[model samples]
Target: MADVKLDIRPVGAALGAEIRGVDLNHLRDDEFAAIEQAFADHLVVFFPEQDLTPDGHREFAARFGELEVINGLKKLDDQHPEIVVLDDAVTPAADVWHTDVTYRESPPITAILHMVECPPVGGDTMWINLYQAYETLSPPMKEMLEGCTAVHVNRYGAGNHEHPVVRVHPVTGRKSLYVNRIFASHIRQLSRPESRVLLEFLYRWCEQSRFSVRYRWSPGGVGMWDNRCTLHSVVNDWSGSRIIQRITVLGDKPTGLGEPRWPKFEPNANGASDFYDKNYPF
Candidate 1:
């Protein structure tokens, strides 16, 4: 394929970029490759004024990889199970910092969100560069976290998995701080109280404004993120309705700097008593 030139503009000093002169509904192979490269460099890339239907959205997202169907989440299109919808009526629970589907054995590698409706003001989304979050850690703290693993439980009572506290990005081969406040239950190597204190500290540290970038949404706007190395949060200050459709690309099980370990027995038992099916959430 011939090379395609794209107009890319960085949105902030931290982790976002806005790409111009491309439409998601009609993208060439070279254009898609350029967008993919930009996504890797920026962690989160936004495209404004590209209108896409549910089918169009899924088609564009599928270009990245196989689409991940999120079970137990509301779907916007019955025929297109890949299109997961988030709106005001459900009271968005993702306001806390999180990487999508970390409780699963293999979490999503990328997430594509398209804005369908937006209030007159507010309802912006924020993303943090986890790679930077790890690099900026003090030497002693980094040493302490080197070989630790953490348990991430599905809050909805679906499943649980152990992931390295510092995960190596499969694509970029860079280390990223992998724990989040929403799903990470505790560090396996630390005592309960010690785990709680360290997790809280890491959560607050990762959320520092220096490592994040906030994006304001508009109709027909699209945000695509590399979920393997970032944590995102949606601002819920908007009173009026807001809607966004999302598609997640399937990913491999997270691998870290050293040998991996699994729990001896099922850790998800004794939760809410709901039948736990292997489900992925956005």
Candidate 2:
């Protein structure tokens, strides 16, 4: 919570908002701080009725931090090397319920997705709050997760990358449950059966309807999310074409600055963690 606030219309007790009085094409520094604070507070900020160009999208993303280069997509212009092009024209295989790239040792902290094209009917994105998902766990469950971490990897299908089952946001200082369905292979150092049971249970808890938000797109929509502690997916049920311009803000290790009551999180030193045989498809 900060001194000044912005217009936030929560989608649920955990997520959702429609911020007003700001334009991506021209935003002041203090105004940008307020928007960032609101994003940190709400986990998901929505700005509708915007028709941003590829250049506009890049400019807006740079205001936050460095940009990320994604593996797929073809529409991205060579001028903006960091922008990720997402659309039906790129790859035939669709992206399932998963977070962006968690393969790197320290993954990108946030992603700004701006809707440039949308289906006339459906094409919504869903965001789940891992913080609230962790908080809602029974006291016994919370205690059980203490000091626990898992591996998520990049795979041919949906990769299994290793990340902490529970992680704390470095900048915002909030704890989040980090295991995602796409990359969560097996908990490191655990037996097969044990890892299976535990991961299955945690996935169910995080995907529950209560701690999430779903946004239906209308061309000019943009969503900025803290990927450190949040899980999100784009809806592909639209049966038609939907395009979005995306840029990710590179982040340090989730446990970089350290915390009072949590275990230290580190996978590799080169900002890319050591890869293993989790063998997931991206």
Candidate 3:
């Protein structure tokens, strides 16, 4: 298996690759290693024509790390707690840009999504390379964020956590712009007005078209991404139903080269109103 060759093709200049010639359900050690290496190099990797069951999906994701149970409103499979069912009726369209579970002290490091159903049109997912987002920042701007941290609160206002403004990937040892518009409330060291301004700028900067890639979903297509160094959003343009099953790999507490500054917990400031679907579509 170590000698297995994989056909990996880059989908975009900034991020994403299409991986061929490997069946995820029947992966060999070397094949899986190649897939893992491709994921590290290309922030997101797409596998086409992979037919996997719920247990198979969980098995594939567990190879990277321990799997985390699906949280929030999404319902989990009664048999497999790690598998989260994402259907149009059960979950609202995630049109906002975010890294998964950033409100938690330990957000997921990676996520593997298997497309079980596809709409007649639209329903593409987009991903941004946060590493590129950080690298492209002006030197002065980078210096400004040296020791800053931002508050991230879940949409349900259940928990509040703070993560470094710029996170260093534990595996790659490279810096990435970590703050996102979905969960980030405000910067701890800045005034309310200042924090809002800065957060808006950083969010817009990270979402620039040049640093991102769009992936069209297909039946039997699987997408895997490093959540620690990427931001992703689902395009909700499709009218018909779209279905995807996701398994997330639990990550360690985020660490940075600079000392971390925790944000002040404001129980009433969870920003539930800012959620993508104010009606709680999910």
What do the candidate models score in CA lDDT, each in turn?
A: 0.85, 0.72, 0.84
Q: Tell me the tens digit of each residue's lDDT in model 1 across 1-282.
A: 238879999998889999999878888889998988888789999999888878778889988889988787898877999988887788454788999879999998888988888888999999999999999999888876867888899888978998999998877888989999888988876655567799999999999999999999999899898889999998868878788888889988998878544332233554532232233221
lDDT per residue for candidate 2 within 131-153, as digits (tens), equals 89888888887765655667677
On the 0 to 100 scale, the lDDT of residue 119 in model 1 is 83
Ranking by lDDT: 1, 3, 2
- Model 1, which residues run further than 4 Å from truth? 91-93, 260-282
Q: Could you give the candidate ranking by TM-score, starting with the highest?
A: 1, 3, 2
Q: Could you tell me which residue pairs clash in candidate 3?
A: none
Best by lDDT: 1
TM-score, model 1 to reference:
0.89
Candidate 3 regions with alpha-carbon error over 4 angstroms:
1-3, 71-77, 260-282
**Residue 198 lDDT in candidate 2:** 88
TM-scores, all models, native as reference: 0.89, 0.84, 0.88
CA deviation > 4 Å runs, candidate 2: 1-5, 92-95, 157-161, 256-282
Clash number for each model: 0, 18, 0
Q: Worst ten-residue run, lDDT, model 3? A: 273-282
lDDT per residue as tens, model 3, 1-282: 246678989999999999999878888889988887788899999999888877778778989999887566464557888888788987788899999879999998888988888997999999999999999989988877857888888878768788898889887788998899889987876656677789999999999999999988789899999999999998878988798888889998887667754444333366533333333211
